[model samples]
Target: MTTLICTLQDHRDDVNWCAFSGNLLATCSGDKTLRVYSTSDFSELAFSPLSGHGYSVHCCCFSACGQFLASCSTDATVVIWSMVSGEIEAVLEHPGRSPVRICALSPDSVHLVSGASDGTLALWDFPSKQLCRTGTVNEATLVACSFSPCSQVFVTGSTYGDLRLWDLEMRQLHAEKNAHDLGVTCCTFAPSILSGGQVVQFRLASCGQDSQLKIWAINKFNFGGYKMHLLHTLTGQSAPVLSCAYSSDGQLLVSGSVDKTVTVYDANNALLLYTLNQHERYVTACCFSPTAPIIATGSMDKTVNIWRLEDGCRGRDGKSVPEQSALTSSEGRKKIYLPIHLCIS
Candidate 1:
């Protein structure tokens, strides 16, 4: 069973992305602000609604230790903020001053990558905040990027429907052309790595405008050869899929779509488990809590819904069970029951 525990209607414009650290939940919006909340009570932090971006903030991510946050915007800069005091630490501008579409930090928080609308990618040494290397994909707008579990390699997806693998020096290691028709919206690597004998394998999930969510297997051989293979293609949504993410255990996968729905799947078997329809507008972003069986979804309706998943999974009739719900706003917390239906698949 899934329960809607909290609803946050704080953003004045469309919410673009939502990310969760160990204890904090950060959400960015087209309102040119980022808001941070406490996972324990879903309360807004004192220094939240961080208004540091000159334009719409496209994406935001927290460092591994949750001490810092990085946000990229159409202002053509990636701003780093201190999580402790909510102060600006550094602002790294894009090379061509093009709008930044995405940004990601390595799992180890040693490296940070920012992708621009002009096809330029800038890699930075996180500790010192120094630009390390710059690369570009010809005539493509970079939208999605993620680093492997080993943190030695990263993958990028572009609006040209291609997925390119890169090494630490920003060299192209391999490329998969036409991976998604239309355009790729988001991609992420599983947090776990598999090693058996001489082969190391990694799993990746990507969603696109073609209304498809794909799972892939990337293998690294002992001889240093790298290969990518398509594993599963999921078509649970009727509209373009916008965002996807893997659970901390790598056992569950979740995705949001323009169909105004969120789908949860069993990652191992590629079976659709639950279909959640709560958002009134396009579901733009979805994220799983790192320490709990909770999900935070942001939408074009300018609201973030926080859902809690109970133990076990099974098909059930779509019905509403009364539960205590709290909504946080600038005024105060309001008590109400926001009935959220979950359709078993």
Candidate 2:
């Protein structure tokens, strides 16, 4: 394997979110720019300066089909862009002291949900361009909001260290938990495909200011009735974990932290990988390629690094040795010599 690094040199300010869709990468930055890059060569594909946001773009994501892009910002608005034409399709505004921190589109792409600093969650109908419903959860500023992979449920975490689940159909609280000891910075639900046979399990991974990554499994159906079991708690970094994602295969999880490193762990909570000690700044975001063994990380150091997992050792019989066993034997030491280079652009 060969490793190639491509420095995205366009943003004048810090990048908040980097999203991948097909062969395209969409980066939202504080520079007021939304850049699209070709994944094949990391070449600039399109550059569009979005002006509606009064301040920094906080978060962005692509639609499931890659047809649309949604972004939230300190400007107190969320904008949906049409990927086909690179045009702004909708601009959602919230008045008063609320600044949208996170925005997510439903699986159907017909609705949108946003969490704001005002501690209110709003559900909007895309075509109608009207607020369909609103839920209040005191005055705890929301840090992140995500729709479950199945699209029937949504979860939001706030500064009060609470995670609340909402049911779209009834617009009611489906489940709630104090998921973290400190302000919850991020939360992600496991994919439905990982639970076998389409029966989606309500397992979620969350991280917070407490510097702990906790996995909570929700096993029941009634509102506030699900059992919360601690699957694992990862601790090591000196700083808080800001972002996390599970590999498509559900066997690995990657997390980025303000500690300036990215750590990859197996499903059993063993530390399987780590990288990025060269940069002396915070690692803001990280994600696994939807179809590759590559992991991409964005950092406050103003660079993105793409890393590939290398096969450690091959037995003389041409079979691969387990990573653990490879680390324990002399032959394994001889077989594992170098880190494979990954080709990035």
TM-score of each: 0.92, 0.82
Question: Which candidate has the highest TM-score of all?
Answer: 1
After superposing candidate 1, which stretches have Cα over 4 Å from the reference?
A: 312-345
Error of 2 at 181 (Å): 2.3
Q: Quote model 2's TM-score.
A: 0.82
RMSD of 1: 4.0
What is the lDDT, from 0 to 100, of the residue 5 in candidate 2?
A: 39
lDDT values of the candidates? 0.88, 0.67
